[model samples]
Target: MHNLYIPVIAILAAFAIIFGGQAISDSRVDDEIKSLISKQLGVDGEIELQAMKEVQKGYGVCGQYQVADQGQRFVPFYYSKVNERVTLDADAERYRRHCGS
Candidate 1:
């Protein structure tokens, strides 16, 4: 009985580790997407990347850009991890135009 319990615990632990690693990988991907979007927009300021809690409605990452001259603005950019692509929305285009991107 004890041997059976140990195997089950090991399997559960392995699953936990795999899931945790995947979560961390997803987070890093989100951060990289935010960084790429910021660079593309020519944003030279403080930037914060946050994951959207609801994946269906919003971009994978939401970027908060704090400009020295114009305060701050929220930018949304789409990120597809499987495809490794990032894109800005129409509103983001307006933001780039306004911020002199």
Candidate 2:
């Protein structure tokens, strides 16, 4: 089964590069994204971020945002590291286009 280990290792490595990179990138920008969301929404408390991945100029983030005690709203937002900005949009596809390549 030594041969079997090679494929398994390759698969595991691929997963690590794909997921691990995103995880690190997410943590680096999560706080800034949260702050921006809070400011834009004028909500207090925690802003939980879900899937965040590095895109072209920055990162594409989608998460549930709590507005006071009202409820949680699904928000699709983007953060451009180059521009140092956060954009909140209802449609992710549109946002992606606007965000550029």
Candidate 3:
């Protein structure tokens, strides 16, 4: 019963952001980025690819992804920024709380 609201909220939030963003990836780039993100999220092919591309920002190949069949619909996923200039560590507490990892 509680699982239904997540994707709905995600879809609604996507609509609000859809009009205010720039294109973030091309076909080839899409494949690469999705591969990286899927591994990072520990998924094989459960991500929403179209929505994945839409969420990435130009500043870096980073954005949120709508996870499928993972209980939570939206995951704020990211990777190193341009030129390896920035790298992020997972929030230990948050990971333990949400991901149990």
lDDT of each: 0.57, 0.68, 0.49
- Tens-digit lDDT track of model 1 for 1-101: 77799989999999999999989976787567657766877876555554343243443333333334555565555554545555567365533442223
Model 3: lDDT equals 0.49
Candidate 1 Cα deviation (angstroms), residue 36 = 0.6
Per-structure clash totals for the candidates:
0, 0, 0
Best by TM-score: 1
Ranked by lDDT, the better of candidates 1 and 2 is: 2
Cα lDDT over the full model 2: 0.68
Cα error of candidate 2 at position 14, Å: 21
Quote each prediction's TM-score. 0.56, 0.55, 0.39
Ordered by TM-score, highest first, the candidates read 1, 2, 3
Among all windows of ten consecutive residues in candidate 1, which has the lowest summed lDDT?
Answer: 54-63
Q: Is 1 or 3 the stronger prediction by TM-score?
A: 1
- For model 3, residues 1-101, the per-residue Cα lDDT tens digits are 68999999999999767744423435555556566666765777666543332222454444456656665655554433344221123364432333223
- Residue 59's lDDT within candidate 2 is 37
Per residue, candidate 2 scores C-alpha lDDT tens digits across 62-86 of: 3344444555666667766665567
Sequence-dependent TM-score of model 3: 0.39
Which regions of candidate 1 fall more than 4 Å away from where they truly are?
51-70, 91-101
